[model samples]
Target: MTEPRLRELAVADLAALAALEEAGQVQPWPAERFEAVLVSAQHAVLGLEDATGLIGHAVLARQPFDAELEAILVSPARRGEGLASRLLAAVISRACEWGAERLLLEVRAGNAPAIALYRRAGLEEDGRRRGYYPPLAGARREDALLMSRPLTEG
Candidate 1:
């Protein structure tokens, strides 16, 4: 594996990003959605792409006083490679630079890996939304775990 380098996602990367998200996320954002985000000042889309291709990506929304981690996806084949953490750090750095005081995100309750990753990155569970995720098959629905991290020493 080549060393993963992070960069602001370019328009050409949308197809690869969409594929990665569709494979990794339960409800992935379509390519046009990401494309729209890329052009907005309120959104920051970052990607980790090496010689092979895009391995991970994160979409964050910039607010006046906070930032929201809207979506994060790492190719299933690229898990456990620390790409997620790197992408997260990049997003956090961008948010901090933009003067955000906190970072927020919602994760599927059943996504243990993502929950663990966010926890390790200093996020704490602050709330929950029942039935936030639609059922995949049967009557089982997934909750949404709200997580937050303070951006500055307080």
Candidate 2:
């Protein structure tokens, strides 16, 4: 396998993005939502592609004072290979380039791997939204874990 390359994604990549989302996400964002991200000036969609095509993606949205990690996913088949970490690094870099004060994200409380990844990248737990995610595969609704990391030193 070749090294995965990162690049900015556009609306033309919607089909591959949707397919990857469906394969990787328990509750994937709808195609319309992906389209919105692709077209929005406030959003950046970063895609990681290898010889087989897109293996991971991260969506970053710029706010007035901070940037939010709207979504991120690596293909289930390709997990544990550090693809997510790479995507996250790019997101943080982009946020910093935009002069964001901080970067923020919300993950499912039950997503241990993702939470760990965020923590390792210097994010701290901010709060939680109880039952923020709908039940999956007969499981109860999961809380959303809010996290953030400063982009600039005080």
Candidate 3:
């Protein structure tokens, strides 16, 4: 397998990105949504691609005082290969370049691996929204864990 390259995705990448999201996300964003994000000035969509095509992507949004990681997904077949961590590091770099004081993200409380990844990256739990996510297969909702890391080293 060829080494994956990380780069900014353009409008031309919409279809491939949408396909990856469909395959990887339980609640995938529509192609139209991806299109909108692709064209937005405040948003940056980064894609990781290899010879097999797009295998992972992350969405970052610049805010008034910080940057938010709106979404990150790695192809199911590509999971456990540390691709998500690479995408996250890129997001942090981009956020810092934008002079964001901090980076913020929300993850489903049940997503242990993702939470662990964020923790390992120096993000701490800022708070949680109880019953924030709709049920995937049952009636009980799951909480959302809000995490953040200061971009400035101090």
Evaluated at residue 154, the lDDT of candidate 2 is 29
List, residue by residue over 1-154, the lDDT tens digit for candidate 1: 5698899987878788888888887677878898899888899999988888888999999988999999888988889988899999999999999889999999889889999999999999999999998887575888999999999963
Model 1 residue 146 lDDT score:
97
lDDT of 1 at 15: 87
Estimate, for each residue in 1-154, the C-alpha lDDT of model 3 and write its tens digit.
7779999999999999999999999889999999999999999999999999999999999999899999999999999999999999999999999999999999999999889889988999999999999998776899999999999972
Mind giving the per-residue lDDT tens digits that candidate 2 earns over 1-154? 7799999999999999999999999899999999999999999999999999999999999999999999999999999999999999999999999999999999999999999999999999999999999898999999999999999962
Give candidate 1's root-mean-square deviation (CA, Å). Answer: 1.5
* CA-lDDT, candidates in order: 0.90, 0.96, 0.95
Superposed by TM-score, candidate 1 places the C-alpha of residue 21 at a distance from the truth, in angstroms, of: 1.7
Best by lDDT: 2
- Give Cα distance to truth, residue 138, candidate 2, Å: 2.2
Worst 10 residues of 1 by lDDT: 133-142
Model 3 lDDT-worst window of ten: 133-142
Off by over 4 Å in 3: none
TM-score of 1: 0.93
